[model samples]
Target: MRKGFLLAVALVAFLFPSGAGAAEKVWSNSVPDSVWSDGANWVPAGVPASVDHVVIGRSKTIVGITNAAFAGGLLLSPDVSLDIRAGHNLTLGSGDAAVNIELEGNAEIRTVGASALAFDAVNRLNLNVPSSARLKLGKMSAPAAVHQSGGIVQLTGTVTAAAGGTDWHVNGGLLYVKKNDAFSGNMTVKVAAGKEVQFEKGADAGASFDFSAGSSITSLDVADATSAVPALKLKALTGDVILKLINVPATLAPGDVLRVIDCDSPIPAAAQVRLDPASAAKYEIQLSGDRRSVMIGTRAVASADVVVFTPPTDTLASREYEPGVPFAASFDVTSSAGQALTVTTIPGSSLPVWLGYVVTPKGGASSDVTVTLSGTPDATVSGDIPLGFRASTATASADMTYTIVKKGSGGAPGPNPNPRPGQPGPLPRPNPGDPLLPDPNRKSRSGGGGCDAGLAGIVALLALLPLRSRRRK
Candidate 1:
């Protein structure tokens, strides 16, 4: 019958043999004391168990594996290298599928017993754990992570979340214990550049530290601001926030009080405030105790820095409005130079023909310009009614001399009870407040030394990361 069907097809191709082209153990030449299961140091003649698929070279790279090494996939491609020495340990997943690992060089990953060191690697992985290694994170999906830069990473067992995102990049190292240590989801910490990662707070988990500005947001949770909660809460997001009142200590005898910024403490006897050496140097900022806290100095009998436009009254009191009742004064169209500043009003033909000049562009985020000297006295008469105002920009300019007085005999309406303390003029040219008179247009700011001192270390690295408050800024 056709020679017995060609001797039964050559005895079924000489007794079965079809694993679909499996073996690919590459680790040729340059034998630097090899022993990764030894077979003349693995090329294709044996020693690579559990369905092998490995490749180690950029010159064979110190291969040694006393035991525990099973692979179905692994490739340290370009300029390669690997070292799973120190008592051997390396386990990659396969059961639930997806197991790929295709790294590029300098890997010194070590391990031990009781089952650890589990990283699936299906796609992108950057786990550079140095300081000799202790990595244990598996149960894969894809986006794998663990960039420790100087070893020891044991983020709990069973390992959850690692499908779309799984981050923990300290960049330098030392993410050891110190406290609770349990972490669940919310993981996104990338504090690099001279790295630092201090952890604590487990049980249920909570942490927040995002040093904005192109932020990858470092996560922290060291806890202890009287921990019932806070261990770390480092998240500094300040583009600008100023209430500066430095070294303002120089007031002796007008009730000698130089409080920096007191938004509103006790005091409410109709709102008391006693500090006005003629509104010092024409005034620049003053809510006058009624609103409390805005006493910046250099005007105790001065003539220039003028702009503390008043009416924060309770004393020196004499505010009697009858003809249309609402004449006001309180100015601070502010500027540490963040924006809006350009005001001009000049009406002094002996002003008040029963006048009207209501430039009300009020304050907040530094916007204070309140001048509403209502009109109605069409005839009730008055005297010295001068009006002038200016508030420039290009660089800066400020001038004001608004005076209005008209009384049909009553008792209140005061200010200017014989106050003449003048002496301050030259300050329009190149603006020199002077430290040797420097101001050749001087404008260099943000220099405490580079990156504005690294953004003041983001509040000293959010008070040196230990975390609390979660939403932080």
Candidate 2:
């Protein structure tokens, strides 16, 4: 029985043959010009069908080694792609390796050592990244260059030319053309030092050019601004940008309030003084320069706006005597240092004893105008407003309150009219018949009750005298 078992085992071993360990399995009927013993295939000339991954020689195979040099090229059809792993080195001509690897649907080529890799018209080329496998070009004599027209190309590692020369050369690297001959979206071209980039006149119309932020170009020669159909709504002129005024109302005029809020950062101050060239009012009142500091004499000083009242047309004719109700004058508070200034107003007084104004920048940002009134008075009295204040926009009514005064043995009351006195102050007088006399609610203490009490008391004393006489009779 033992002899029979031994004979059967020998027969089985012979039939199977250990030669399977030495043989290589070929798939998809794909054959290589030369294959290594350790199952590596080499296509020096080129491959007929596209390949996914090609392994190079291992420890065993000295397969694809060739002493006679020749030009090798690999052309992958549009539907196929190529992937070359690490440790693969393909040597070309006795002079330099002239290997061309072309992949169709977005190919990747990576090389570990001093080698060169080239691409042709691939959608995207990822070089030296493991995730996106690429063809390796081991140490050679020429520089590695890539040219692409359509998709994105990223360089994971430093790339040098195989052919060492300062002169211009286009190694068989990336040469891509747009699949549809149309302009790409948001195209930005960046060129670095020791790098040369060129652009041919685009087939379509001219496009907008932006000299990146904080970046300066030595010279930009545009054919013509009018001819180039630039899509940019604004263009920078002499480092300052000029924008087209959009949605400007026809009614906007010089001295009229035009407030723009919530604008882009670093917005330039708007020219306050704008003239209408075509109108009869050709020369506009220029309130430009600085709002914060006005040059007084030779010195720069912060001053508040002083406007003399322009008498109302309706009251100018009817109102009585003297320089007739002077226009209330007030000021917008501003400081010498382009900062918003604030002034406190007397309670109940429209005229701000202390006022605030946006310090117009010497060359900074724009400021807004806000009005606040304070102080106690018999009536609400407003002061002269600055140039930016349009009366139509003011909350004050057409009528104004003037301080009222009575002789009362005193020639004038309370320092007589301030601002400009002897204009016969318009202080309110107490009437004997008025039931609301000596209004306690009045803001001014003078008008509140003192005057009304004095007049009412005198009349009561006379009435009491008659009553006392009748009682005595």
Candidate 3:
């Protein structure tokens, strides 16, 4: 029985030797020319007839692999642009074999295989596929650097993704989302050293994106539902940094630390933090205070300083010079500081007589005149100024004194030149010609003694009578 089995195996090997050898040579020399023109699709230039099964040679472009998949596996060479349009699906067969399409220049590929589409040097690779295509990257010998400059990984169909289990790097490039389409899935989306990935409009807002110092993402605006109206989410990966907040609102969650060094005055009143649900693992909400020591989870931090602004109080009060007062207007001033206060007037307008004084005006007159307070007197400022008027008409001479009194106390500023509830008029000015105006003293008449005719004639007759009496005697 052993001899019979050995004979059968020998016969089988003899019959299938050529068939078995054909499959092995399929990958050998699979590389094409430097450039593959549209001759007939993957059918290399010169394939020997005696070889029977053609092998993929080095530095060759494998054009149409539709039939090549049925025949055997296809091998792609490096520094070669593999241009595959839509509806071209290339598959990798069993035994853990690998196929690679090198995109040296501009190239489009619809890949569905265990193998990967590698960009050896700086190159643009466009992967256009139908419904979400999944390709797994086993391991990277070196870093898989994809330089997609002016090349687009377009998804003409519905939701699609390109996920990498291993490290997949994108050096200086863009992940452009075409209009009316969406790209989703968990992707590291690494930005290589000194490279960036800018996400423009129509790009997914919630893309699990991070950035390097030399790299950045652009046109990334937040959803309208968030408290941060049209804000940005910067995935912090480095040490202490100050993220500038422009026209965007900022909200802090519990366990989130933020530092504000120097800020301009008059901070917006609407500045506050709101809890974010998407990142709930951190905390609910965190609000900063004024210079107070607080904690955002384990982060020991302090709040920003609050500034209070005050306006000028000079317009409400004023002062002027009076004759009797020293060099200052006799005005009253008090202090709520519970200490003696000093009032100073505008420089150059300082009084020459009194250094400082409080003058209270009272009367039924226009109250629009500017009233000022000046003085160093340290009591509850309340007092009056005496108004004395002397009349010197063509006939009479008389002096009138009127008390200019203040009704309220405690320096309650009020009616000057006008009479208060208890005070008289702001000492009335003496009238000369008006007879209806009464004189405070009854002894002094209105006119002077110059027009006393009767008294003068009586004096002359009395003088003559005295003379006649003297002669007769």
lDDT of each: 0.43, 0.28, 0.31
Model 3 lDDT tens row, 30-122: 445322222233333332222122223334354433322222222222333333323333232222222222232332333333223222221
Task: Give Cα distance to truth, residue 151, candidate 2, Å.
Answer: 5.4
What is the clash tally of candidate 2?
39
Worst ten-residue run, lDDT, model 2? 292-301
Ranked by TM-score, the better of candidates 1 and 2 is 1
Candidate number with greatest lDDT: 1
After superposition, the stretches of candidate 2 with alpha carbons farther than 4 Å from their true spots are 1-71, 78-84, 93-99, 112-153, 162-370, 377-473
Question: What digit string (tens of lDDT, one per residue) describes model 2 on residues 420-448?
Answer: 43466546645535666642223333644
| Candidate 1 CA-lDDT value | 0.43
With candidate 3 superimposed using the best TM-score fit, by how many Å does residue 37's alpha carbon deviate from the native? 14
- 284 in model 2: Cα distance from truth in Å? 34
